[model samples]
Target: MTDIYRKLYTSSMMPSINLPKHYNYIGAFLSLSCNLSCSYCINHLVGLDQRRKHLSGAEWVEGLNRIQTEGPLPISLQGGEPSIHKGFIEILNGLRKDLNVDLLTNLQFDPHKFMDLVDPERFKRDLPYPSIRVSYHPETMDLAETVNKVKILHDNGYSIGLFTVAHPDALEYIPAAEQACEENGILFKTKEFLGEHNGKLHGTYHYEGSVFSKEVKTVNCKTSELLISPEGHIYRCHHDLYNKITPVGHILDPKFQIDDIFRECTYFGKCNPCDVKRKNNRFQNFGHCSVEIQDIE
Candidate 1:
């Protein structure tokens, strides 16, 4: 479809899906296909349906534009490598200008092409973190090459940051990577490894028996973030998204509205680390978790 026609067509088709009073995030997973297959990938911590279809860029634009946030909330575009989507550039260009956007990438795409087409201002925001974050995997990527890409983009007025997971096996390499980034004046940060390595789990969780629990049980769960899959299906948490659990609604479903209430969950033990991890809330407070899971068995 032509750019002008797509813009005009997608502008006003669906009703706005408003965020709950306590909502802190909106995850827009454009695609789950990635170039690298790191052994410790969190997406595979439980299970992932690789065959799920991704929404075309036009469909994504049309559905995502219907969201209305409380403040300057950015819809985070993430994936195995969101840049792998065929219409990655087009989706980036089509979203509403007032709607802020964030990217989690592996620096796998061409930087020159990105700079040529996308305006740097599209991602710039007054926030504590950079809008574009490049996840550095020591096993799958070369550190120097990744840093070079960051330099190229940051120099061209893009607010970008380099982050690495402190995996148990790769801990030795993270220091040098951070040092390289620091010496070159690039922003470098480390994220806690979320999944398993060897025999034990690696991260702190809000709920006990949530990660790799021996037995499954039922619990009531409520989430503050809107999690959308590649196909635009809504999930209560990352576990449901990766495991292909039935979604609450599709972004394109016209009659849909935020329920803002707890829903019963059967896979309480196999919850994703991202949902249960004790982390900072939107205000940067320390004891925040994405989902409030209750009545565990």
Candidate 2:
């Protein structure tokens, strides 16, 4: 095991809740509920036993406004389906301008409403990829319909793309979707499936035995990023936040802040592969994990 202990840099480095200083990024789960329930959905992987909490439009604006994002990085608004959030548009326009805004949706809503409500500049970016990423689920969604929506949004000057998961069952459909997207002049891409499939684990992960296993152990974990649950609670790892296994603080509280510190966790075996996996950084460069966990003692 690799144990990396260095100077705590970000506001998330404190052990206890305090004011967030250098927030690399902020994610607000507007709502965990989705319109289409894909079988391969990671949100449903651990079973939805965890309590679901949602913030109203006003509450979301208040919580999101408090975040201090660094650089051009924006607060990624995602959920089981971000569009499902009741206050989706209000929350988008409500965020402070200093804090850039991004959205990850399923394109399950009315595009006319979206275009009328959100300003294209609000999601503008100099980055290579679109600021708004829409997931296209083959089993639950029609490619033609999805593409049409993308076209409408694209024509309206919205920066967007269609992202699909490469599940084993749906692998064959991705090429077809890509072809359709190409014909329509749209940006389409596939993401590796990251869960159990036909008794085999998939996706690239940095840590061994972190997924599809029953064994558990203790370890010291540190995170360079900020993770917020749908209810506004902050977490140390994707596992603790997504599974509701544990949390450090809630953003709803005015006094809550990102406390960056190495905390002992016993659910090492249950950790989400996304957290431990060595993957691409924000620059799309290889070698990055949502969390940096080590010191397995």
Choose the strongest candidate by lDDT.
1
State the weakest 10-residue window (summed lDDT) of model 1: 1-10
lDDT of 1 by residue, 1-297 (tens): 234344544447567888877899989888777789888888766444388788889888887888898777888999878888888889899999989899999988889989999999989776688899999999989999999999999989998999999899889998899899988888998888887777878898999889888888999999999999998889999888887797998887766688998999998888888999998776667888999988886
Model 2 agreement with the true structure over 1-297: per-residue lDDT tens digits? 001111322223423333344334467777777888788888886654255867677666766676654457667898878887778878888877767777899998888888888888888865667888999998899989999999999888999999998899999899889998899889998888888888888878877776666988888877866777777778887788777867786665644666677889888878887677676655577777666668754
lDDT of 1 at 80: 77
Q: Which residue pairs in candidate 2 have backbone atoms (N, alpha carbon, C) closer than 3 angstroms, thus clashing?
A: 12-259, 12-260, 13-260, 14-259, 14-260, 206-277
List candidate 1 stretches off by more than 4 Å: 1-11, 46-49
Span of 10 residues, lowest total lDDT, candidate 2? 1-10
**lDDT against the true structure, each candidate:** 0.86, 0.75
Q: Tell me each candidate's RMSD, in Å, in order.
A: 3.2, 7.0
